[model samples]
Target: MSMYNEKVIQAFMSPKNVGAMENPDGVGEVGNPRCGDVMKIYLRVRDDRIEDIRFETFGCAAAIATSSTATEMVKGRTIEEALKLTNRDVAEALGGLPPEKIHCSLLAEEGIRAAIEDYRRRRQGLPPLPPRHDAVCHHEIPETGEETRE
Candidate 1:
């Protein structure tokens, strides 16, 4: 069998911030059963910054590793800064994810952006971003378990 990268394996085996929050300021979930990956991200924001982040994921090793590393990356980051984080950053932080599983990292990044947008909407007294327009829709999952486009 091919060997997996040490850091990727480590992060997957011992994920950081791997639990849900008691009362998260924002929560976002994304899944694609066609690919058999699902993730739920939780956040606690303070002064327009992410004070804490956590996640619960059901997927392969790459998905778990990406989510864990992403939670750490977002902590203490302003909403705008966190939104700037991309799947490439998450994969790079994990020493790179396999090409076939790259979507796992993308999912983690999407989850973070979704959570932050939700926080922003709530703070500004606006409704959540519509699923179709948000790029990372979380309001409604399609029957296939993937996000539906408008």
Candidate 2:
């Protein structure tokens, strides 16, 4: 069986908004220490909405696909709307992802939230938020059928 579905392959082959923005209003970067997959998202916000979004990712096919899908999901969406997005939403948008690669989708979700949070902090004249190191494994292991550590 194919490791990736059609939607995931499409996004990986031709990722949308792949480059970093020249002068982004906000930026969020997240990395998985276990897999060494890193994702950085840039946002252009106006009127509390994401007018444009872009991403740069260093990882496997699933990571690239997740970043591409996440950017597309949040573009033109209000901050409130974008904040509601979850890793499951990203995976569903990409048709689905392998159990082992699910963490990639979680990174994408965190990237968007971090960028928006940075934008809000900047607007309020507050310092940038610290890097996020929280675990992203809230899903059950498909192989062992047991809960994994965070």
For all candidates in order, the CA lDDT equals 0.76, 0.84
TM-score of 1: 0.80
**Which candidate leads in lDDT?**
2
Model 1: lowest-lDDT 10 consecutive positions = 141-150
Clash pairs of candidate 2? Answer: none
Q: Which candidate's TM-score is highest?
A: 2
In candidate 2, what are the lDDT values of residues 1-150, reduced to their tens digit?
328888899999999999989988888988755556878899999998999999999888988999999999999999999999998889888877877788788889989999999888988999876666556633334565322222
Q: Candidate 2 — which residues are off by over 4 angstroms?
A: 133-150
- Report the C-alpha lDDT of model 1 over 1-150, residue by residue, as the tens digit: 224588889998999998879977887777654556778888899888899999988788878988999989989999889999987788788776555566777788888988877777777888764432234423222234232111
C-alpha lDDT (0 to 100) for residue 52 of candidate 2: 95
Off by over 4 Å in 1: 1-3, 126-150
